[model samples]
Target: MDVIERFCNIYIDICQISPDDLESIYAKDVVFVDPITTHRGIDAVKHYFSNLLTQAESCKFDIADVFHCDGNNTARTQVTHIVNWTMHLTLKGNNKHITLDGTTQLNVVDDRVAYHKDYYDLGEMVYEHVPILGFVIKKIKGKLAS
Candidate 1:
């Protein structure tokens, strides 16, 4: 399958992705950064994904749009792809459905991702999903928006 297809599937069920698949999809020194954590190297990236999977009962991505830009086709150089997506996850324990709006920027080198970063609201994705915290967060947001 193509890179975009692979990318979509990978996030849908990160727990199912094998180490070999991780190796194939990311550069050895790939770096990943998101709201909660930053990790470097494919090994670290795999670990982060595994942990994220463990926190959620289910994870899925709704890809809104994908844009690809090819750069100089040379070793060590990368092409860029930006993905605008929504993440739907069932939070552990509470089983609350959390839908977070997000986007990802990927730098691809030799068909493998060399760099990745995700943008999303930590409050919407996690804090606001907590039982007690959810109420407080909603109230705070209401006060601020007024």
Candidate 2:
């Protein structure tokens, strides 16, 4: 399959919640970097998603745009994530609901993903969710604003 087609297949498989399909898209030694942690190898990558799926609900991804260059074997996807619609995030021991929007850059080789980097605001994901934490962070921001 072509690079673009390969990417689409991988995306569809993921949307189907088949983490094992990563084997077709990720190289034997892949590096995945995100706001949470850095993972190496396909198994580690699968584990990361496994954990996230367990904690988050809905977990739908809306692809806003995809910018790809077949020559460079690289692509960038702007996406919006809606998580936990009916459920709430447990923050420091409290339940909170949140949504996130972010971009992901993928480096591909041999039509398989090699290095993946995810960009997003941690505050919008974590601090903004918890009531007490969000309030404290907001108050702290006031002092740093000047």
> Highest lDDT among the candidates is held by which one?
1
How far does residue 88 in candidate 1 sit from its true spot (Å)? 1.1
Q: Model 1, 2-118: lDDT tens per residue?
A: 666777777666556665677767889988888988898888987876777678788788888889977766544343889999878886897788788898888886677888888
Give candidate 2's whole-model lDDT: 0.62
Give me the displacement of residue 107 in model 2, in angstroms.
0.7
List, residue by residue over 47-144, the lDDT tens digit for candidate 2: 88777656654444445566753453223322122111111233223344465677777776666677777788788787765779988888888889
**Model 1 per-residue lDDT at 105:** 86
**Lowest-lDDT window of 10 residues in candidate 2?**
78-87
Whole-model Cα lDDT of every candidate shown, in order: 0.79, 0.62
In model 2, the Cα lDDT at residue 134 comes to 89
Model 1 vs truth, CA RMSD? 2.8
Q: Clashing pairs in model 2? A: 89-96
